[model samples]
Target: MKLIVRHAPLFALFVACGDPPSDTGKVVAPDSPSVIVDTPKLAANWPGYYSDTLPCLDCPGLDTQLWIRSDSTFIRLQKRIGLDSIPEGIIGRWHVVNGLMTVGYTGDKPEFYRYTADGLLTVDEMGVADNSKQDWTIEKFADEIGDAIPRMRLIGTFTYWADSQSFQPCGAEFSWPCTGGMDLGEEEGEPIVRFNNADLQKAYKQAVKRSGDPWTVEAICTLGMGPAAEGDGADEYIFIEQLPRTIERCP
Candidate 1:
């Protein structure tokens, strides 16, 4: 079975809250008489970030993590109930229309969201609230708290290749292949970080000193890109340590 490795354990707590019903409003046509004209502007803290466990009919629950960045980028990590698989993460653009947040996903219809002071309410494809599913919400997290944790792209459990002196990052609930191994070279006496999460760095420092195998402690790290391959593409991941950024023991 695939393992479920998360960037930080703190976010696991987001699943405990109860999300209210989605009575915010209904989707309307551009020229409809019922169109919401006085849409509320997004709150300054509305670059919503949340992680929660949602009620599931097929399984025990669905573990999900969501991040809506200031730059209109969105990332969501989701895993099914009772399945021991890496949580798949998707990153793309997000926009707000008529007080509803729309998340763009690849080859899939955009997911609509309604924001409240408490958390984000899930809207179905028909642009209506889905009351059928319980806990259809992700509690908002503070920006500093969210920033303290590494972005979804850089979160995962990894393995070390002693023979080749390489580090292999494995997917926790997703099926991502790390064709290019990770690099640990320092820049200015610190680990080269594209996505800097201060807490994550401390974990790496702790991992490096562990007497046991490296895989026994999961560390936030970056994918290696050769100097000749600079600007080839964005770095796949970055490590940010949170309070509960416990390393996953190798299974």
Candidate 2:
């Protein structure tokens, strides 16, 4: 069983609304290092992102996306949902260790990924295999609050569904998954089951008017690896775009 870590415990509470007993004593580290991401690069031939999970179709859990910056700052997003909402918080970062591109949190003590030149992110660091970096997904955001939180204003009764900006998941093996490499939902060749970015926004508004239920949406943005299942390494590829999720409504 892979352990799926969230962006922030606070975000979880706002979205899901049930705290495990272990959440009570969780201490917030006083000082976390600032993650200065410089962007990652994708294969010149295939410079785009994909979604790992089909959003709206598979919108109930953690959403993610793949991001490749120009300077070779490879990234994968986790704990994201929706594609057109505001952001709440972010927990992941991009890093390079010993010539390997890795994704992790910005912390004094953080998990790191070592990417192969091909760009498939994996874990060989020798710890927490159960929570290996491979288990993570990436998502693109419309805004910092696209990781939207549960909140209710005192004087106003504006219902805001939990949602995020635009993003995608790096797919198991593909390139330019969505239309123009973003979640347009109208990708002529995309799976019919997956919903696109526009549909996500439509759903969010409908939910807000109806019941303020937060739904998560995402695509697995990945580097081009293949039609062959035999290859698995960072060097294989990278991705862009992200899915967002509106978990719950804040009263």
Candidate 3:
């Protein structure tokens, strides 16, 4: 017997029992009951501002500010205290697993954090708390931080399903509808011009071995609100600016 796994209009994956499907599609083993893959929801009090000054070997210290949004996305800002350089900002997806939170960035190893009575404490990759730590905890803020959305490079799998194109960012559970274009304006300002995404679409199509197959890709992207794929309300969408190449898998 075969099971028809449907991801809510995204795609209908046929899973064969006993024997794996000969097709090179990514499918869970027959023993697993869940067909839909989604990241675990964060705790109620997990969405907030977390900050700390970490010890730096070559500098005075590293001041870090992390904003955990309710949308599973995060903004991180870090600055060397004594350096003249400006603070570096990074945007990525955050998820919780096994009572620990992991922040994943494109092409970077994930960082883990464990919830504590006071706040969130830094932990190793194996979820072990630092032993000889000198204040590795990040204090939580009561208020939210106001920061602009920054364009970021994303590594994800692109799929053309149900006549719609979507991208699933690496380490992210949900896939967002993707639009190919370049916005030439400030984050809050109205975009004056829009660039076509013919090349990007062409690259994605060429990478797919079979129709409706998901292709791992790397691209520069921006997040914005748009019409939902199947609903009446709006949802967050990924705007692709540049498609570099199709990667073998998520790095």
Q: Which ten residues in a row have the lowest lDDT in candidate 2?
A: 148-157
Among the numbered candidates, top lDDT falls to 3
Task: Give a tens-digit lDDT track for model 3, residues 1-251.
Answer: 33456544244478778887676655544443446556554454778888889877789888887889887778676778888344554557888878788886755778889876567888987778877857888888754544434455567888875568888877665777887875566555755434445655677677787758988877667667777867699877778776666788875
Each model's TM-score, in the order given?
A: 0.45, 0.25, 0.54
Give each model's whole-structure lDDT: 0.51, 0.35, 0.72
Model 3 residue runs over 4 Å out of place are 1-44, 51-111, 116-119, 124-135, 138-149, 186-195, 230-232
Clashing residue pairs, candidate 1?
15-53, 85-173, 86-172, 86-173, 86-174, 87-173, 87-174, 199-241, 200-240, 200-241
lDDT of 1 at 183: 39
By lDDT, the better pick of 2 and 3 is 3
Model 2 over residues 68-104: C-alpha lDDT tens digits? 4444333344443654342222223455555444454
Q: Is candidate 1 or 2 superior in TM-score?
A: 1
**Clash tally, candidates in order:** 10, 78, 0
Superior candidate under lDDT, 1 versus 3: 3
lDDT of 1 at 109: 63
TM-score: model 2 vs. ground truth: 0.25
